[model samples]
Target chain A: MAKGEEAAKQLPKVLVLRPPPMFKMFEKEFSEKFQFLKAWESPIPTDQFLAAEASSIEAMLTSGSRPVTADILCHLPSVRIIVTSSIGVYHIDLQECRRRGIAVAAGGDVVSEDVADTAVALLIDVMRRISASDGYVRGALWPIKGEYPLGSKASNCDILVICCALTDQTHHMINKQVLAALGKEGVILNIARGSIIDEKELVRCLVQGEIAGAGLDVFENEPEVPREFFAMDNVVLSPHRAVSTEESSRAKFELISGNLEAFFSNKPFLSRVNIDE
Target chain B: MAKGEEAAKQLPKVLVLRPPPMFKMFEKEFSEKFQFLKAWESPIPTDQFLAAEASSIEAMLTSGSRPVTADILCHLPSVRIIVTSSIGVYHIDLQECRRRGIAVAAGGDVVSEDVADTAVALLIDVMRRISASDGYVRGALWPIKGEYPLGSKASNCDILVICCALTDQTHHMINKQVLAALGKEGVILNIARGSIIDEKELVRCLVQGEIAGAGLDVFENEPEVPREFFAMDNVVLSPHRAVSTEESSRAKFELISGNLEAFFSNKPFLSRVNIDE
Candidate 1:
């Protein structure tokens, strides 16, 4: 039989909404088990392609920052399950999924430890000026610049460490006054989603010396950080990869594959998320 | 009274062998208790100055990276005490101090926590590609480079963490074979003195991909890093400042002062190092 004919003999079709950039590494492995309907790769528009090709698709895969919105879900009437390679379902229309009775599975507790480790790493890098001094040494400015500026202590103070999800209400929660109260010696560390803090005001605070420094893992427009931050020795920038160690990536792949396999086999989902919220 | 005479009358004479750059921040406070004969500032040669002026100097303050050699110690016949603003005293001639029965006080447990924090920070920075990505972001190459290269996982492995003083025997302990055993994915972190590792071999291993990455706070040479390391993304360089935090510095000031006070007052030193070693 031809390859397409053999592929048609696979299990239930799974629509993949914007697979992660790295998903291609595991694409062949996943495709061997289930036929993937690539909505993003269609020559036609997504909606028309989904309606024409994925109308009978009962399972879908979402990974990275792809938003599985209600409008898109309107086309997937047969989607009984949505398996994501992300721990957070904020990108998915959870309410719509609830109304549609679509079971949701997330990339469970595997990433929390890595996320916590990244948070601490960013914190120390900011407060101890590790990344900045690293820049100085790398830039060959140390012999000329003398001592790189001293950074404030990370502990033994009233500094607050808050890590939470960035919902509508909590968006832009860390505004100017909040940073002001944090004071000149205050350090802000953000490992969560960047929209939680007002990035513009954060830049302003950091530039004006209203706040001391920051260690940022995520930005409002990721991969497009402000140019102002580039020159500042006080800020440390990390690409939005707090939970992206090789170990974590392997764990994520296993969990995602397991979830898809479980869904197809009609077994209990491994890491089902409550879609009711 | 003249400034020198008045200063001499007000405080007990204590020689300072290369005072820390930040010592001036606390120098006035320290000077209230002990008259510091600045060896580095002497017009005559250091040996000549020590023989003519500091022969009667019973206490000496060493900070930063100044070497208190056996030859230098020969000039100080009356030296009974030495106080340093560092936890590591590889720069000081311990055998001579032992033979002379001179009590040496060092920055004690106060720096251990900060040093450990730095070690962890460097490890995570190297393993997570934090510093490299930070540089990429700063250089405005993220948009062009796409995602930064994935880094090796740091934990759940047979990772060895060693922090110790650089002694004659321990110098060059981490040579090519040690690094080779660490393999292509191992990461080496140096927060102690630089000579402990064969830095040339380290550079060669890193360049040849024999070992994965390194995070070096101290180098075989200070303020002068290898030009090759300047271009490498896998390496993170810090200017020998693993124990430098504003909070720790204040604690250090208190400890150094207390040690000096204790030594002068004929009380047991707060952080006296065992010179018998």
Candidate 2:
């Protein structure tokens, strides 16, 4: 037999839907353990390609951005496992997985520390006007405008940080009354999904001074943040990168490999999601 | 005897050069404990006011902005104690204080926590492009500009934080060599005095991309940051407010009062400066 045929026969058949960018860093290791069927790279349409060739695939690796809907799952009858390199598995149809008894594994707690750190950093930046003053200085406005205005004391001692997944139950979690209870002196720090909060209400509150300020790393429509948020000095914005630190990425890689290894060897998965509920 | 005269006789005379804003927060306690000779509030010239009225004042309370010069000290021969409501004593003449055997008290470690927090916040903001991206979104540029260029990973691990007082020996400590050692991925966080760094060399290095980025709270010139810094996205600027938190201000007030009470009662000061060194 040919060497390629021998290798394929020996390895587990795994489907990869829209491979993540970090996959390149671990491509060699993954390829050695499983023969991957790249659905996105196939010349035929993804649905047709999966229906024809991926029916025999027993395991799949994916990311948060790709949706593993019921329609796609219907084509792969032999698929028993779905492993995601993300903290949130909102993209995967959990109900369908639970019904089919398909095990779902996620990167859990790998991003908690980095996300918490970013939340605090954003809170400080918003309260102290660190980013605004930096912008003022960088814009050459400081030399002409004299001293920047004093920022509100960030340490009135209480702050709420929201870092949760966007599910039907969690969508629009932060509404007007929650913002009102926080008061004009309060600040909001969001490092979670944008859809978790009502974005329009948040904008209105900030504009009307119902809430003091905000530090956001996520938005309702990412890569398309509200235009109104751009004009306020009380807001500090980042490009949805609370978990982009190199250290966390490396940890994620190790976790993903470990989960895959555990699944193939018939051992319990490292970070398997409890879908029994 | 008159009630005013009785109160004056009972309270120890404390010479206050300039009342800080925080003094208002503790005015009642301060007035009850000591008879303050307010120099700034005096209609008479400061030199005449000091020589005539405050000569016999055994204790002096001042802030960082007030200069406790050799000339000021020469006017008040009977003054045995100098207590400043600040962490740094750069405005005071240490050599003259040593020669005269006068005890100098300062706010020590009261602000250390707050300053350290600010330093970390600024570092994260600069490295992650928090402020720059905030500006981009606010300027209505994000929609037109598409994507913000990715910032450098900034987490090569080691971070150098400078929170030292700028004295003759420590002035301009971070020169070109130090910046070079830090390399392109290194970030400098300064919540201390700006004079501690050679501002000109820092500007050159930042402009030439010699160092990754910087977060500066203090500047070489007060209220006048370098114009060049205003144009850079890699730098995060704060208006010398590393110790401006409300909690820290209260702590500073308590420390000042404790030091003064300790000195008056013939106990060692809580945060006495070592003049002999």
TM score of chain A per candidate? 0.92, 0.93
Identify the leading candidate in terms of TM-score: 1
- Poorest 10 consecutive residues by lDDT, candidate 1 chain A: A153-162
Error of 1 at A256 (Å): 1.9
Model 2: DockQ vs. true structure: 0.34
Instruction: Give the CA lDDT, 0 to 100, for residue B151 in model 2.
Output: 45
* Candidate 1 structure quality by residue, lDDT tens digits, A1-277: 9977676676667888788655776777776777778888888999999889888888998875888999999998899999888776778888899998999998888888888888888888887888888878877888887777666666643354547776777789999889889998788888878888999999999889988788888888878999999888778898877878777877877788888888888899889997665
Cα error, candidate 2, residue B187 (Å): 3.5
What shift in Å separates residue A202 of candidate 2 from its native position after superposition? 2.4
lDDT per model, in order?
Answer: 0.83, 0.82
Poorly placed runs, candidate 1 (over 4 Å): A3-8, A158-162, B2-8
Model 1: per-residue Cα lDDT at residue A123: 84
